[model samples]
Target: MTFAVNPNASLFLLPDPVTCFRSASYNQIQTFHLTADASAVILDWVTSGRRSLGEEWVFSRYYSVNEVFVDGKRIAKDAMLLDDSQIDAKPLPERALAERLRPYSCYATLFLVGPQVQAVIAELVRRYQAISVMKMKSPDKVIWSLSPITGNDYTSVIVRVAGEETEDVKGWLGEGLEPLRQCIGKDVYRQAFR
Candidate 1:
């Protein structure tokens, strides 16, 4: 059975060379599978575009989607999206596949702003060590003095802990944060432990 969505969308199939060389019929079947699998397309990212004084600037929305399928299945068993907003700062498909595989793993992202942001981050690292969570990736923090000429004061980070809830993580790190100077945006999630 053939499946199609947007009639305007074109499909290209790269078939197995060996089978294609042996018989044209086998090549046709492989081509069919490729087109069939690609019939379903999802919009993963869209950014707002506006012109200012005849100049256009494109901002990064950081929106994306990852689809996982079962063994030998084309249909996705699970789909997850990177979602963050002022009201709801959480990753999509809360019941993700990794959650099932590793029950104790947790992930949290922090967006901080302050002059003492570096000190706050240092204290946070010390506390994370106390909790014994592995630092999966190098953090991306910006210091005022080291930052570019543009006066943008904000630091964003992603960290993984050993629990599903990041309440403790936020509470401890939130201590040194200054109300007027610091602003924290966080998103908590569960994933397979590495």
Candidate 2:
């Protein structure tokens, strides 16, 4: 899918989580083009197949790519590929893709771009900077990170989150992005989170 935002205009894209099925492959690509003054919020996320059916990470493959261009110049590009067939552990016991991502069943990525999101970016940065990571016996229920796109005016931010359950990630994201309500309006923002 592709999107184009006009100058000074804002757009919000909140899509449902993608679910991969066993023996199936899922691929998605999205591109956004925006004028210097345009603003946009994009979200891409996926679940680890049907958990109740015991099909977690049983899919053959999963691929996703998201790119953003401002004034015809590429600002950010995020891509991920997970394939069971690509696992090759010749010297050790057999390994599966699920092993690499154990303890997490949901993953999400969010992008905020343009002047309108400066406040959101700043808030996220402040919160992220205050975190102190420490070694633990078990992984956290949810983990997230925030980073700014380098080489660009500090108007863009990328957030990645992984959680043991889908609802956990959703709640975290909803709170983290609460400032967006001012730009996208309370009604629209509530729709996305609710």
Candidate 3:
């Protein structure tokens, strides 16, 4: 079955904002039982505007419990993040790395804090699609095995840049950030660390 947004919970990006839910209905959600690979597609859908409206949503599995809770109910906790052995030690194939780095000379995982992040994410998706020749929507699309980071009060995004230098990539991300700050307010904090 195709994934559908839960009507019960609020819709927002993961890495939950470090604040209270904006509305009462933002609790009690439902979502698909997405595997790690399929999650990239789902996240793309969110960023791509396929699932637009809905405040409260639900997930088939609670991926993490860092700071996500609704009505005193804690979401499922991920034991893997807590356990070192849970990670696969194998290195990525050189070809795969080359392919991911191709076109985009650098990659970084971004930690963004501000309001209206979903809106900001939508813009990022559009920009990435415009600039990157790759068919996929975002860096996570190329690296589908990585799990989505879900937290309350904060959210993480992955970005790819045409330049390898850290300063250049930072500038690229910063140039577009001004528009987002307008929606989310100037208190936005962004850190793009690989």
> Residue-wise lDDT of candidate 1 within 19-112, one digit each (tens)?
1111111111111122222222111111111222321112212222223221223432222222222233266444422333233222232222
**When superposed on Cα atoms, how far off is each prediction in RMSD?**
23.2, 1.6, 16.2
lDDT, residue 59, candidate 3: 16
Q: Candidate 3 — worst ten consecutive residues by lDDT sum?
A: 41-50
Q: What does candidate 3's lDDT look like per residue over 1-194, in tens digits?
A: 22322333223232311111212211223233322211111111111011124311211111112222223333222221111122344584333322333443333334232233455555665665565345755443232112224453213343323343334554655564445555434544243211
Q: Pick the candidate with the highest lDDT.
A: 2
Task: State each candidate's clash count.
Answer: 0, 0, 21
Instruction: Determine which window of 10 residues in candidate 2 has minimal summed lDDT.
Output: 146-155
What order do candidates take by TM-score, descending?
2, 3, 1
Residue 166, candidate 1: Cα error in Å is: 5.4
Write down the lDDT that model 2 would get. Answer: 0.88
Clashing pairs in 1: none
TM-scores for all candidates? 0.24, 0.93, 0.30
- Model 2 residue 8 lDDT? 94
lDDT of 2 by residue, 155-190 (tens): 698899999999888888889989998987899888
Error of 1 at 15 (Å): 48
